[model samples]
Target: MRRAAIVGTGAIAAAHAESLRALGDRVELVAVADVDGERAAAFAKEWGVPRAHPGLAELLRAERLDLVHVCTPPRHHVPIALDCLAADVHVLVEKPPALSLSEVDLLVEAERASAGRVATVFQHRFGPAAIRLRRMAAEGVLGRSLVAKCDTLWYRGDAYFEVPWRGTWDSEGGGPTMGHGIHQFDLLLSILGPWSEIRALAARQARAVQTEDVSMALVTFADGTVASVVNSLLSPRETSELRFDFERATVEVEHLYGYTDAHWAITPAPGHDDVAASWREKPSGVVSGHRWQLAAVLDALDSGEPPPVTLADTRITMEFIAALYASAFTGTVVKAGDIGPDDPFYKSMEGAGAPWADAR
Candidate 1:
């Protein structure tokens, strides 16, 4: 059995522990580590993990682990992942993998030299409905994807930002665009292909944070499709939604956080009633969550293949995020491949800092 350890024991770490428990036979949960030693020990006891460490360095020195889950804060992701790669241990890092494109490139280079691979946690793409949608779209069952809408409108009050790192550009990476809505838009990118250009704007309307609480973008895909995206922390009726308007039908999923088949629906255009059958043919009952994704990661290790949400796949989404910020901050249209090593945005999501930095 493959041996695994989690590097953080926080709220999200519980999901990782539960998933590893679910895949109990295939993988062994050997140990855990956290900055708070007492919390780590408690988590280990609760999860039945064998050992606990005060930090990743201590855990690495004590264990011969096959995989490490980097569930730490945004700023720590790259450093912890670098340590894992140096030890040739595979990593399943949580979302917003790195704070900036520069940090992502650092992991990409480290991965190239390591015997193990890295995968980002983007569980939405693994759900049965999303899987079926991708298959249908690829088979031309959906016809040309004309337009799309991705919205992550979730409410987060001022108290939510009290968590020292919750609202900062350096620690949380960004506001809703980086922290919340990325899951929805990443699923959108998996359905549609590469995005070409983006024009966007961001504002700190509600939350008193260093980052923008609301942002909007108009995106143009490489295949000539256009989309509208919005990430906000001010909506009372919270929901995560993605809608794709293909020539044959419009496919959508609306859920607050995680989703099952019940959350998805399709409405076919006139003379395309057959589309419904294609959507229904796929087996259901799979919920999008860490468990589904962790299982896939283990399967890949068994087959000697890279896991889902590979670095290459994640960079596409990361580039889109950086471009969105670049567009919003500069008041100009930012395109794919527009930000390279020399561009300020390639090093920091805030680039030269947000336009409203002075106010903050």
Candidate 2:
């Protein structure tokens, strides 16, 4: 069995635990760790895990880990992942890999050096809606994609900021873009392809947090496909959706918990009844497939297949984030893929003092 250890025990960390337990006989939950000793012990007791480590180092020593899942906040991903890589353990980390694009580069380098795998949790990419939508797009049911959009209009109250790092530019990265909006947007880019350039406006409206709780962006892809993205944490009824409009059809992808079945409604464009008829004749589509994503990684471990999500894919997201920061900070559009090894963020933004304390 592929033995695994989880090194964080917070809310999302609990989700990791659930996914691991869901892995069942194919994987074993070897241990859990948290900086807070009591929390670690409590999690271990609750999950029936045989061991609990008060710190990450202790967990690594106790468990012969085949893979390690770094579920700590964004700030903790780099250190924990580096430790695992050095010990020759495969790693699966939560999204936005690190506080900044540069930090993720280090993990990428480690993955290369060890020739092992490290996956970012683009869990939304596994949601029911995402899987079906991707297949439809690939099969041209959407018929030459014309437009894509992502929205995360959600509400967060005063109690939401009760946590120390929620609103800050530091611990949690940008308020919604990195924290909440990254999910659907990642799915958008995954389906639509890398963007050519971005023009963005971010504001700290409707919340007493350091980062923008609401933001909007206009993106232009290399193929001239255009997209609009709006992300917020202050909406009354929160909804996350991504839609793709193609020359011949439009497909809407929707999901909840960022998991579960995502419905896809494919409608033919004004004069394309034939395309819709073909879909009706061949409607043997797939279901919302989060479990399938997990199965991919587990099967990779079993058969030595490379994980589907890779560092290059994550770099595209990071490059966009860096450009987003540049746009937000400079009040101008930023080109993707323009930042390179010589950029200020390349070597160490921390030492240079990043615009955001977290630099993401």
Candidate 3:
């Protein structure tokens, strides 16, 4: 059994612990760590973990872990992940793996120098609905993907940002665009492949934070498909939705956080009723969450292959985020390869400084 430990005793870390427990004999949750000593010890006791440490250094020195889940906030992801990789321990980090693409590049270099692999937690891609959609697209059953829409409109009050890191450029990165909508948009990118260019706008309309509360973008894929992307934390009636308009049918998934088969639907385009029927006939029952992704990570480690949501795949998503921020802040169309080493957005999402910085 692979020995696993989770750093960060937050709610997400508990989810990782539960997922590790669910894996039974395949993996073991050996330790828990947090910046707060009491919190880490409490979490260890609560999860039945044998060890608890105040920090990653203590945990690493105590146990020879096979895997480490970097469940900390975005700013700390790269440092902790690098340390784990240097110790030859595979790492699974939560979403928004790093604050910037440059930081991701550093982690990539670290991984190259180590025997371990790094993966980000994008559990939405593991759902059966997502799997079925991917298969349909691959099999040409969905026909030519033309237009798409991804909306991640969820409500977050001003109190949510009182934590000091909830909506900052340096800590949590961008607001809804980086934290909330990334899941939906990442799945969208997974379906549509490489994005070509983006023209976008971001605003701090409601919440009191250092970042934009809402962002909208028009994205063009390399294959000539276009998409409208919306990420918001100001919506009263929250929902996460994605729609892909193919020549044969329109496939959609509607869910708030996670989704099952019942949350998905397909509408046939006139004579393409077979497409709808085939979608229903396909196997589905999995709910997208940490558990599903953890199982896949364990399987990949067992087979000596990179885990799901590898850093290379996540870099595409991160690059798209960089492009979105660049387009929004600069009032210019940003392309896939446009945000290279010299771009400010590559170093920070604020892109030198947000246009509205003085106004705020």
RMSD of each: 0.8, 3.3, 0.9
The clash count for each model shown is 0, 4, 0
What does candidate 1 score in Cα RMSD to the true structure?
0.8
Q: After superposition, how far is residue 146 of candidate 3 from its true place, in Å?
A: 0.4
lDDT tens digits by residue: candidate 2, 176-222:
78877887888889888879999977766667666777778999988
- Quick one: ranking by TM-score, best first? 1, 3, 2
lDDT of 2 at 176: 79
Check candidate 3 and list the clashing pairs. none
lDDT of 1: 0.92
Candidate 1 colliding pairs: none
Q: TM per model? A: 0.99, 0.90, 0.98
Off by over 4 Å in 2: 259-262, 271-290, 342-360
Candidate 1 minimal-lDDT segment of 10 residues? 277-286
Error of 3 at 265 (Å): 0.4
lDDT of the candidates, in the order given = 0.92, 0.75, 0.92
Off by over 4 Å in 1: none
